[model samples]
Target: MSSFNRFRAAGPSSLMASAHPGGDSPALRAVRTLRDAASQPRMMIAQPFGPQGERPESDPARAFGANKPHPTAGWIPPTALAALINGLRRWIRLRALKIIDEIAERRMIDRTRTLDSSRHVSDHLLEQLPVPVWVEDESGRLVHHNRAFRALFRREAEALIGRSVAELLPETSDSIPVETRLDTGERRLDVIIGRCRLTLPASSPDFRSIAPVGGRIGTITDITERKEIERRLRELATTDDLTGALSRRAFFAAVEQEAERSSRYGSKMSLMMIDLDHFKQVNDRFGHAAGDRALKLAAQAMVEGLRDIDALGRMGGEEFAVLLPQTSLSGAIEVAERLRKSVAAIAIPVDPHPMTVQLTVSIGVAERLDDESDFDRVLSRADAALYRAKDEGRDRVVFDQPRHRDIFPA
Candidate 1:
């Protein structure tokens, strides 16, 4: 029998009707099934025929007719139909494999292009950065650094790469908030270093490795100008411009602090109030320039006699105050005596040749008492003693005695 007649005998009645060209046929149904399978690429390829070869299967190819035995008398063997179906399955599998390979290749190409673009962007950004930036590997080896970093270090990228952080920054610690000075070429830079953890995408080639790898990113900021500004500001706030002694405000602040400490800890603290004897007379006789010279000379002499912990400041025109921490009344008196002698010895050279003027200071010493909580109270007593010193004689030191209060009405 011919192949068509043999298929008609073995196939179900519904399948035979579908095989015809005019009506809905098995060939068209197979084409529709293939289209659906292509839409769901992940789904397994399904068989078009049933076990008995009675009709096309309903699933996967559900558009085809249901199983119903052929009405003809002579039955064609199913082996022939099985052979045809097997051949069709092989074709479908080969086609599916080809499509899968093409998709995989396309994805790989796109991923490579994306990685290259990202690398280009990163390089551009690093180059454009104004501040020095560097990257180190897990072993603290320098892997990459920007142009600013190279300029600061005065080294080429090739020389810097693979070098350890210790080699680059010998004096700097690896700890956070690292501060170090870099003396490169003729420039001196005060650098502040900060770092952060580095993370990469899971798709990165380094994601699967024998040893874990990560980067340490750091930024270096130059603070040399800032440090200089701070130093100048501190000098202006804390010291007198003319005599190089503590400023009036700074001296009072120091005395207030010392007074609090003495009261809190029951520690000894002494204050001395000093005035240049006949200072106005010198200004009147030798002019204000000589008066300024005399004042400068007197301050220098007093400073030479004082200990390092002693603080001296110009209170006003000719008045000055000293704060002596951890000193008893006797020690303060001793210091005052030495300062008095030192002041008396100072000779101001008025005219470049031979003419000189001698100066002396009257000092009053007051020790912080247990009852005195305020610095002003100590200062008031010291002022009274100073007046007494001036009254008795200039160039002498006077120790203040506590006043006795009368219990009964006078």
Candidate 2:
């Protein structure tokens, strides 16, 4: 038999028969290879990887396209069928992937809608709450906030969303924030937002671990009124209501502080004790109201006559003391003399039409001695000197002469 005819007889099935008329050529060899691959398994739409992560020259089906059918003889190549099957498989695979993606996308959209609905409900509840409430994402960006929160800033929610805490509170402080409202003047509320760690359970409840979910969620408290009340209460405690001077407790505290400063720094400081002369006679002759008026006038006179560094305090009824920081005994004596003159100048008008009374104060001054670490010694000496002044006759300033005196102690 001729080689060509025998080759044709031994060639692959009709679909894969080579078109080339050449007997046992490269085309025939290619056809043999394709026929072998086709005989093994059907082609599927997949990209298979090799050991080296490379694709081979042909997918099993690609072999069919290379051996097209003989045009004149009207016989199709196995490659043509293989190419058609490959195209069909690819289209079907693409369609399946597209369908899966669409399903996943729909589910995600539904989940997002549900989350948005729940957030809307939570937001409404927060809005109705009396205090301000806010929520931030994991990155500290403002995500959700209530109507009250927006109202605090007087801003729309759209303006605030996606903004960070630093951007919201321009002061950049975690302390009581004096935040500003949009388009409005300053509204000073001590906005106290206590931060707490936000967390999420990343594990099951059986072996739970807390993981940080995000930024912060907290309610704001306005403590402006409470702070103001506290301030007023402190003032009432430390201040004498009738005389507008430091109360006995507050005055003694001031004296002690001044004494400590004087002792530590080796600086001179002085104390004075003053008594309104014939105060009891005036009160008995007129009335307690007249006496109260006289006391108020005397305190006002002392406050006006003294320096800012000086503290005048009403010790008891009709008796007062002055604390002179960074001053010597002579300076205190000068201050006491002025206070006595001022008191002599004061004339108190009682409730009645024809009753106006005059007064005088006997003043005694003492310096903080070198050895004196305690302010009590200075106060006692001043008190003793005050009595000495009263015995010598009222309305005079007497300086306590210490035996061993060092005005500035080292």
Candidate 3:
């Protein structure tokens, strides 16, 4: 009988474990199985036969399997079949382990590449920003700053790196969108600072539901020029260019506001209408240039005589107006008299010669009534008083007197 047949008759234990003196460990069993399978005869086949000598119509040896060409067809040995099945099982297990390892390695490589790409993009974006930008870590230390940031501080990026934001900009706040002033030598910079917290993407496996890892990112902008322009615009809108007093429109607006306040609180307020006496005669004799000088001089004197709470404005040509808050009719008359004296004291020099000219003012005073809220009503009464002042004399103050209404027509 062949060795294959003899081994099969003895059973599976004889092929796997019985060959080793010490019981078969898994590794030893695997080795012995492979070794035994290798030692089997190369030529072997399986064939079916009937009990009585008879030829089957189908070929009996066709189904038999072997690793090599057989000299004669025969039944396949059971031990050979067992060894082939065991070898196939081992090959499948090894292939599965190799595939799992490959997948794990590929995932690690992809993660690394993604991280590198993200870091490169972040650095490039920060570098290209025009405004000063910086990032701080959780400990409030500046971890990164852009080129603009370095330029703003007038220092090298290397020197500023790893420094705390508090050390560099003492007034910078962690809260967003604040305006601050920085005095750098002779220049004053108006800086606006905005802040935001940095966070990792939600797709990252390391993402946490709590606060982000990095502290905050900040941006700064200089607005000094913008602020200066705004100031100049306000001045132009509120003041007259020729005399530097409130413009006619601005003065009327102030009168309306003061009238509303007086009516609301039952407080006393007064208005004065002033006219430069013989202003037209001065312009005709000395020319318009001299008239302009006289007007400016008159405005200056009036400004100097008035209190801080009083507002003065050029109404038109030679007419001017003053608003006095918390003042009575008598008090308005006193201020008007002082202003008239101040204007009379000014002696303006005519151009192209040593000749000088003097000017005087006529002022009319009227107090706002608690029942009358309209500025025009108070202004009309003051205008009537001014006509009276001019009729009586050129340089004097006149107060509006109360008039009684006639119940029946004369």
Candidate 4:
């Protein structure tokens, strides 16, 4: 048998002997059976008695030369009882240690999760920012910068942190002139920094700029792309793709805007509606391609005839419009006559035979009145004058007078 099994076998037997004072207790038999079947001494440790007629730590009765006197008919073994108490103590200690270990492990896990969550949240905020932002202390020392700023500068966040703004950006070191004051009460430049070229050590030139406000806040936006897109969109919306003349929608919108500005600024603004004469016949005689060439030629002539400040737009089919800001009614009519003569003089070359197409335009001009703010009323007057020009015969310019019924019927 193994050492533990032997210990187990002897344990309850020893207990049974202790229990039987006269060596004949009834409980002695039951305790003996427990010791014989147990696999380990520890398992038999739960028995309930000490050695018979001996203390818990004493040798066996045979070695001690002890003989038991009969006392009680039924008694528990003292060795078994002592062993049970010791086993209970061991179990309690093990359970307490297990509980402590679990608590420590749980606390460690919670700490790690808290740190990870904080870092994740911080990274997300940096990436989502729309504008470049950087924070610095009162001493102009960089403390925090978002991802936008890092990407633009091509630098790491760690390298920039704790560095002085002046030290990191030598070009902008003197940007804060002597007159401006930062939030830290130190004098610095308060103006926006424009794009300045920078030559790197081993590469072509790069651009850098800054928008530092105070020691604490800085924000910047690269306006190069924004400006370019805005310029292109404006050109497409206003100017005709083929002839470079303003579109119909842009023409009326300009008239309305000019009217409002004139009323507010106490300036005169005029509108001229022009139509090409015999434009349909040109297309009917030649192909549609020839007609397109004639329209482009007429538009160019009208543009050359007007002032740079005057706005002209193509109003679909053969009609066009002109907006004259700060111009009088007579001046508007004179300008329309010039445009008509210019179109009549254009010799549009469209064929291999060197044939030139002749064209003339009819015009209607109207100036804004003192109380005129309604765009619809102004346009009606201009249209009426245009019909009058065509009625009196085409190839002529007509001006509309400000009338009560023309503006508002009584």
Instruction: Give the poorly placed runs of model 4, Cα more than 4 Å off.
Output: 1-91, 102-151, 154-241, 264-266, 304-309, 402-410
Clashing pairs in 1: 18-25
Candidate 3 ranges beyond 4 A from true positions: 1-35, 42-214, 282-288, 404-410
lDDT for model 4, please.
0.69
Which candidate number would show the highest TM-score if scored against the true structure?
A: 3
**Which 10 residues in a row give candidate 3 its minimum summed lDDT?**
198-207
Local error of candidate 3 at residue 271 (angstroms): 0.6
Candidate 1: worst 10 consecutive residues by lDDT? 196-205
Tell me the spans in candidate 1 whose CA falls farther than 4 Å from its real position: 1-130, 137-141, 150-167, 171-216, 352-354, 403-410
* Tens-digit lDDT string for candidate 3 (1-410): 76655654554455444333355434345544544654554555334356653335464443433333654324445665565576546656766888899999999999999989998997898898888877666676777788887887677978887786557653652333422334422222233333322111111222122223746666665655665677789879988878888999999999999899999999999999999999998899899999999999899999998889889998999999999998998888888989988999998899668889899888888888766888887888888778889999779998786561122111
How high is each candidate's TM-score? 0.59, 0.59, 0.62, 0.52
Clashes of each: 1, 2, 0, 14
Q: Rank the candidates by TM-score, best first.
A: 3, 1, 2, 4
For candidate 4, the 10 contiguous residues with the lowest summed lDDT are: 198-207
Candidate 3 matches the true fold with a TM-score of: 0.62
Most lDDT-accurate candidate: 3
- The lDDT values for all models are 0.72, 0.72, 0.73, 0.69
Give me the runs in candidate 2 sitting further than 4 Å from their true place.
1-121, 162-212, 404-410
Pairs of residues at least 3 apart in sequence or in different chains that clash in candidate 2: 64-79, 65-79
Model 2 / residue 9 / CA error / Å: 50
